[model samples]
Target: TKTFVEVQQRLDDVNSKLHETVSGAREIKSFVTELDELEKFDQVNDNYMKANIKVHKLMSLLDPAIVLISNLAIAAVLLVSSYLASIYTGEDKVQLVGNIAAYISYLQQIILSLMLLSMIAMFVSRGEVSARRINLVLRTVINITNPENAIKPGIIGEIEFKNVSFSYNNVNENDDKLTLNNLNFKIPKNSIVGIIGSTGSGKTSLVQLIPRLYDVTSGEVLIDGVNVKEIDLEYLRKNISYVTQEAIIFSGTIDSNIRQGKVDATKEEIEKAAKLAVADEFIEKFEAGYKSPVNQGGANLSGGQKQRLALARALVRKPKILILDDSVSAVDAKSEALIKDNLRTLKDMTVLIIAQKITSIKDADYIIVLNNTGGLDGFGTHEELLETSEVYKEIYNSQLGGYHE
Candidate 1:
């Protein structure tokens, strides 16, 4: 919020400055105020703090360097020309020396100009160096690894995690403890598995392993009986469609963003998927229908609209496995019910929904409830867990306390 307000103020100042420039009035006050506002905005990112300070220091010294270089060059030229004229016309050389001296004044201006050009060239070299350094930082790889001779796995959507253990940077401890401790699990050929947990219960991390977003520290993640690391990375990802809490939308016609799921998907298929996700009603109301240009990150759309659109994009693919990581949290209860209702009839597709809301997955065939300490607290259906699992009962009690008479 602070960043947004600061940027808005800076933008308004910039607009006023632009108007001043166009009207032939170069207000020094406007430029200074704009520069100060920009400095405040830069503090928000802190991306170039060190480089900015160094650049400012260099700028302070640049004028003196230019003056010294100019003075030295002029002194050299004047000394040389004065000596030459004196040697050529001994006491009668006043007029000749004066003419040469007047021309020698231009020599200082030429030297200053050359110094300015050199400074510009130095700035260009620094810019290229800075660009190379930035590229080097960006090139550092994390989880993405593309292997040669990668073969595609068979069409079975069986997911298996074998003793998978994961850890992050050991800021406090010298050793890395497992966030998912010696975990072993398997999803059958065609079954919807619901993963329920409190916030930061390693739900996201566990699912991320199947997609190879993050590799297991000690074990293997398998899809379709083949380890994900050994399978063709592209083909493995192509068979799975994932949606998360934050819906990523691009700026373009709604049709274009949905096409990213399956580039060659027919219009009929797109419309069908939209209908299934209950996004058709709102989309049809737009003047351009599917062609309505969505703003970047779907800023032009409501949270519910973005979530539904993302769901529709996921459904359009008709992948072997649908991994939804709290994807419907933003949608309204009615919309969520409609989409879930449609999902009941889907066959041959394995759906894995990771959710925090117990009401969302109460009817799921299998619910794996996770505790805050990164271990499975319970695993069963809503009624099954309520009867047999204490953790599931607590979650149910917490979310639907009033409903319980």
Candidate 2:
């Protein structure tokens, strides 16, 4: 059973890789030589085929072994009974025959019981392996959880990070390697803060801490002057709406998907959110309008459309804090500008925009610049950063095609 489990795992891995390869076959053909790509695909295919063959072979042997054992037991019982009956005289022979019949019946019953036991053993072995896998998942301890006396803050959107540091590895806090180094920053209430950095600069990691998605290795993230770890988990998350870089849509009507943000939202409110996100224009064009069906993961929608819908979903919630993690990258410049304009109307809510493009965040109230080494380079307005931060200045010049001065 252990051997079968290991083989099954390998087969699953190979099948998953093969599915990915097939889905991206066009891209592979465009970038890779045909022969080389075929060889790689064939190797994975061979592994799957071999695993399948082995399973079939095992089934064939097991079934035949059970049948052969049963047949042999029956033949041995009959042969012994026949020989005993032939050697006995008149009355003795009759008694011997009756005894032989009883013995044969008992032997048959034993053989049937053994066959059933063999089948049960096979099933039990597989069930044990499956149960162990499920238990491993069930027994896993969640690293992030609400404290015993969690606070529920009355005020909503003031955020601060004090001398914060984080590492993916929880052990060895003294280790030199960290995803986010010691950092401190404050985002005032009802303000738009832009976070910009090169790849792997911990931009996402920093925002994730705001919601306690991960606990800081050291220092603290505070909300409304209270340590975030002390805040109730549900209360903290309910006040923040996060739209990730990749828009995730469910298999349902557009109305149903948007309603996920605010379950009891009215039709008017949903329409208002779509307009704010600049999604209503496209949605109205569809014959079904808001009732249009969205396939799984929004595969039926274009990238920009999916992003617009996600933005609408976030806006519909009227959250105290909204975080956009490169959510508008797929939208055109005109649409992006309109969305930014609409965001200005959300005066009571604090907003955080993490973007790669400088143009997307140039007009933000304050910009937080991070260096490649996971340290803060600057935190100020665009003009202030251009003058004071080399990293910010270089990025600005590269995107705008000139020196700020």
Candidate 3:
């Protein structure tokens, strides 16, 4: 059983390595680590092979050894009975021989049952180990759920964070562990808000709260004067569409990918959304156009193209609140500008864009500048932030060479 467990672990490690190399093939090749990756995989595979051989050798010897001992015991019984029979009288010797035959038959049955029990015990031990692992996954709890008396809102696309703070771990006792600290901001209906921050500034954490992905440790998040916790979880998420930095493109046609946002969307609506994201230009170049097949993870398309397609998917939803979480970072300035310009047509949608580049969000109606401590340093137009926020000004100067009028 111990050898069996070792083999199982080694087999899992080998499988993990295989998946990592296959999924990260491009990265491995670009870094010129083909030989290194091959060596790592070979090592893992060899470990699995050795472990498997050890388990098989032990198991194979067990049954044969049991049979050898049982045969030897029967031979000893026969030899002793024969010696006893020689010392007995005629009728007594015959009776003694008959008794020895019956004893031998009973001993054979006992040995056979014991051998069967041993095999069953070995398999049961392996099964028990696997069952414990499966039970752990099944017993895991999901922390987020709809609150009591949840309201299905008739709300406008407004958002507010009132004295909000959050952390992935328990921050109720120690506030110092907060990822976002006392973030206070309100976005009116149909407004555009830009959020800019350095790495680890909790930019993603802030936007995630609006969708109730993680409940705040302290304070509240409100939409249109009503607390988000009171709102129906499903309704709140349905009205919001979030596009992340990494584009997830499934294996299917272009139409199917964008239609994931709205399953019942018309073909024309898909095309319109693609045009808005500037994805239509390259898409039309394909011989199949909307019907063009996409490889898994958008392997067939360039990084910029994948970003544009993902943007189109979000736009097609026409959700009340749209979030672009650095979704256009891979695109060139010309294409990114066009997508931003096209977004202006959605006058009734509240949009939040998280960006690393000032050129991407400087023109936003309200730009949120976050410092290293997850505190808002500025919340105003680009011109206003240039005077109020040193962080914003420094970023603007570095990216654009200087702040423009």
Candidate 4:
């Protein structure tokens, strides 16, 4: 069992290393670190080989030892029974022969049983290890579940944070290490809100709260006058669309990927979404159009193309609230402008754009400036921020370098 566990652990490490090496192959070549990566892979592979050999060696010894013990027991029983039968001929030779035959038969049965156990020992050890690994995941406590009577809400896209605070780890609400500390804001329905912050200022964390991805450590998050925790998880998520910073693409056709947003979406809806995201411009050029196959992780597409496709997926849902977490950062300036203009036309849809560049959200209805200390510095229009927030002004100057918006 111990040797089997070692083999499993080493195999996992080897697989992890292989994935990392393949994913970052370009970086390795550019940095001229091929030898270093190869060395790392070799080390893990060697460990896996050694662990596997140990298991094999143990099995080799165990099988032979079991067989040898069984054979020795059978030999002793036969030799002793035959000798006693021959010597005790004075009393019923026929009865002594019957006893010897019975002893031999019993010994053969025991040997067969031992051999069967030896054959299945490898399977038993493997099953034990696999079961233990699976049980760990099954035993994890689920921290979120639907209430007894979960509300299926009719959403209008208004969002509010009332003294909300959050921490990834277990910590007090008043703890300084909170990711978002005591946030208070109320966004009207159909408004374009821009969230900007220095890196690690909890911009993503704050938006994630709207969908109840993580329940607040303290306070409440309300959507359309209802506490988010009271709403049905699936229903609430259906009304919200979130495009994360890293666009994830699965192995499938472009149409299939987009349909992930709304499984029953019509051809017209799909085309419209593609056009709105400006993805149709490139997709139409493909011979297969929407039927074009996308490689896993979008290896065939450019960074900008992947981001545009992800945007199209989000827009296809036509949700009441759209959250773009620096999603347009990879696209060209013209495409970004078009995307922002299209967003303005989505009636009654609340939009939150988290951007690193001030120009990305210069015309936003409201701009939220999150300070490096993990709290809001200001929340207002662009002009309002320029006048009030030192953080905003610094960021603006650094990016624009005196260029007018």
Query: Against the true structure, whose lDDT is highest?
Result: 4
Q: How accurate is candidate 1 locally (lDDT)?
A: 0.77
Clashes of 2: 0
Instruction: List lDDT for all candidates, in order.
Output: 0.77, 0.88, 0.90, 0.91
**Which stretches of model 1 miss by more than 4 angstroms?**
1-57, 60-69, 76-114, 125-129, 170-177, 402-405
lDDT of 2 by residue, 29-97 (tens): 898766776787688778767876776687667767867876787788778878877787899888886
Candidate with maximal TM-score: 4
In candidate 4 the C-alpha lDDT for residue 217 amounts to 93
Sorted by lDDT, highest first, which candidate order results? 4, 3, 2, 1
Which of 3 and 4 is the better model by lDDT?
4
* Candidate 1 TM-score, true structure as reference: 0.77
TM-scores, each model vs. reference: 0.77, 0.92, 0.89, 0.95
The clash count of every prediction, one per candidate, is 0, 0, 0, 0
Off by over 4 Å in 3: 1-5, 57-61, 76-119, 172-175
